[model samples]
Target: MLAIRLDEPKQFRQIAIPEPERPGPGEALVRTHRMGVCGSDISGYLGHMPFFRYPRIPGHELGVEVLDVGPGVANVKAGDRCSIEPYMNCGTCYPCRKGNSNCCATLEVIGVMVDGGLRERFIVRADKLHPSEKLSFEQLALVETLAIGCHATDRGAPTDGDHALIIGAGPIGLATLEFTRLTGATITVMDMDQGRLDFCRETYGIERTVQFKGDGSELARLEEITGGDLYAVVTDATGNVKSMSNALNYVAPTGSLVYVGITTQEISLPHPLLHRREVSVKGSRNALPADFPRIIDLIERGVIDTDPWITHRTPIDKMIASFDSFTRRETGVIKAMIDVSGVS
Candidate 1:
């Protein structure tokens, strides 16, 4: 078996390792088919991802074909093509007990905090699999990414006919934008990248976008765009601390601000602004179990367009060499999928 490992930052090595053991009770052995390269993966590769342990096998956004299942695995079976829920939670924890396993007290996120599905064969708890017959492996890989926004939108709780301001138009931000759009909220997207903002407008029909310059006119532009009052919902997926801190200016009074993106830096907010508006602030972690299924149905039903999201694909062998350029944005990469199916 071959596994890709990031032995340390700025290094990725492929080594031949023994195949994984047969599944234990309630486990399934899956052949990883498609893996998505995410923004955090880029930061992780560059040694910037917070709490990323070295020598990690980083791949959380996965699409796998079940090779076999162990005893007691009822929902998934051999030949099932599934999108995996990669956040492993300790079921006894308070959060897990309350159906908030996305932030389980002892949560283990595949790729970020532990070895994930970056190999030919991987074992996972069978209950985490969400089988889908109507989508491709590439689209299946996108489910986890889309769910980031799904869970965030759930946290933001935007209502119909309301307005939203999304900071950052990157993959995480775009995923946030997609689910938020489904709630019937009109959206305004901000980004330093013109291409990404243009993509939001052209692809999702998001008409309002403001180019962000560190010069500090973004708040003013957003106020003008929203007709004096700021948006009823503000979602920040930039993972940039400054942007996250500054986003407080855009939320309407009594509106919600959801932080889907995270950083190691401590974020400082003005107390007066928070007090005067009585705005609610919350952090959104990974998706709950239902998020994968919800986004899967939306994609299958043609409500959310998956075609325009993927911008690159390559076999696993070539991924390491091209990864630098991928991070550098040399090829205008929106989402890059690695094909690991042919490996033995």
Candidate 2:
């Protein structure tokens, strides 16, 4: 089986590896039909992710077809089309015991912690696979990405008529924009990339976009749009340390600021500013089980647009040369999907 193996930071090799083991009880063997590359995958490849292990096949947002179901697997069966939940948690942890599997004490995310779906086939726990009959492989592959934003929206609790400011117009940011629309909150999306900002406008009907420049004038632009007070809910999906650290200033007084992007570096906050404003800061991790079903409904109902988000497509065999460019945001790429069914 051919797989994308990360031999080291900034290095990946596409090689023919042995097939994964057959599913055990409570698991299923799935053939990878399509896979979406995530920012976490890019971070792991660039040495920004501490949990990534070298020589691992890295992919988590997967669309797959069940080849066979393990014994006692009742959630899905052979020939079922599904998308996987990437977060594998330690069931006994305090958070997990309390139904918050997103922050489990010992969480092993599929793509980072183990060999994920950047291969011909893989095995996953049966319960983690969400059966979606309405979605194509390409659309279903994006469920994990949408789930990330869903988790953040749930945590941030954006209210009706509140102004929401989402920093970064990348895939996660776009997903946040998509879900926030459901709350009837007026959304103001900000990003340094004009292409992505345009993406928000043309695709999602988002009118307010702050395309930041290195100069400080973008802050003034944001303030003007907000009528001098920024958003009630500010989400930083840029995954940039500077952006996350500076997000508090953009958030309205007593507003909630959620860091949906993961970063390895320490982010500093001005104590006086945070204290004076009584701002709330929160970090959101992987998605919950509820998020997957909600996204399925959103996609099925045409609330979320998957067609435009996917900008590039390549077969699994062409990944070595294309992977780096996709991760670097080269080629105007938004989301790149691999067609594993063509893998020889």
Candidate 3:
């Protein structure tokens, strides 16, 4: 089997390893079909992710087909095409017992803690697979990424007719824009990248786009867009400590702020201002099982368009060179897909 393995920062090699053994009693052998390169993958490549380990395959957003199902695997079987939920949780933990498996005390994320699907084949627990309903491998691979946005929206609890401000126009930010639109809230997006802001306007029907100047004017620009009330809800997907820390400045007095992106260092906040305004701040992690189907239905109903997000495609054989380019944000990339099945 050929897999993408990272031995160190700025180093990735395509190597052939022995094929994986048959699935265990509660596992299934999945043939990788479509894989999406996420921002975390880029961070891992640059040695920013704390959970990343060397000599590991770095892919979690996967769409797969079951090649063989082990004993006791009743929910899915051979020939079933499904989306892989890569989080492996220990059921005995407090959060897991409370049905919040994303915060499990002992969590092993595939492609991060273990081998993942930047390969020809990978094995995962049977329970993590979600059956697909005619979704293309490329579209299904995006379920995990979009689910993060869905989870963020759940945290913010945007009300109908409210104004929402999302900072950063990356893939995750764009996903948040699409899902929050369901609440019928007017949206204003801010990003340093004009190309991404343009994308938000053209593809997602978002007309309020602002170029972030890293100055104090960001708040005023957002206020003007929201008709002087500021945003009723603010979500930061920038993954920058500065942006995340400054998010409270733009949120309305009683508004909610959700941090969907993660960083390694401790973040500072204006405690006095936050307390005075009675603002709520929350953190959003990975998605739960409840989010996957809704994202799929959104895709199926054409509420979210995948064509614009998918700006680059590469076959499995040319992965190394393509991966290098994709990491650089060449051509101001939005999303890049890997054709693990050797077709795109």
Writing each residue's lDDT as its tens digit, candidate 3 over 169-189 gives 888998888789998888889
For model 1, how does the per-residue alpha-carbon lDDT over 1-344 read when each residue is reduced to its tens digit?
Answer: 88889988889999887888999999999999999998878889988888678898989999999999999999989999999999989999898899899879888888888888889998899999999988988889999999999989889998898989889888889998888888898899999888888898889888899999988788789888889889899999988999998889898999999998878899989989999999999998889998988899999999888899888888998878978777865478899889988775
Cand. 3 TM to true fold: 0.96
> TM-score for all predictions?
0.98, 0.97, 0.96
Q: Please write out the lDDT profile of model 2 over residues 27-114, one tens digit for every residue.
A: 8999999989888888887888867877788889999999998889998989888989999998998999999999999898888988
- The alpha-carbon lDDT assigned to residue 265 of candidate 1 equals 90
Model 2 root mean square deviation, Cα atoms:
1.3
Judged by TM-score, which candidate is best? 1
> What clash pairs does model 1 have?
none
Q: After TM-score superposition, what is the CA distance of residue 179 in candidate 1 from its true location, in Å?
A: 1.1
Looking at candidate 1, the ten consecutive residues that score lowest on lDDT are: 322-331
Query: Between prediction 1 and prediction 3, which has the larger TM-score?
Result: 1
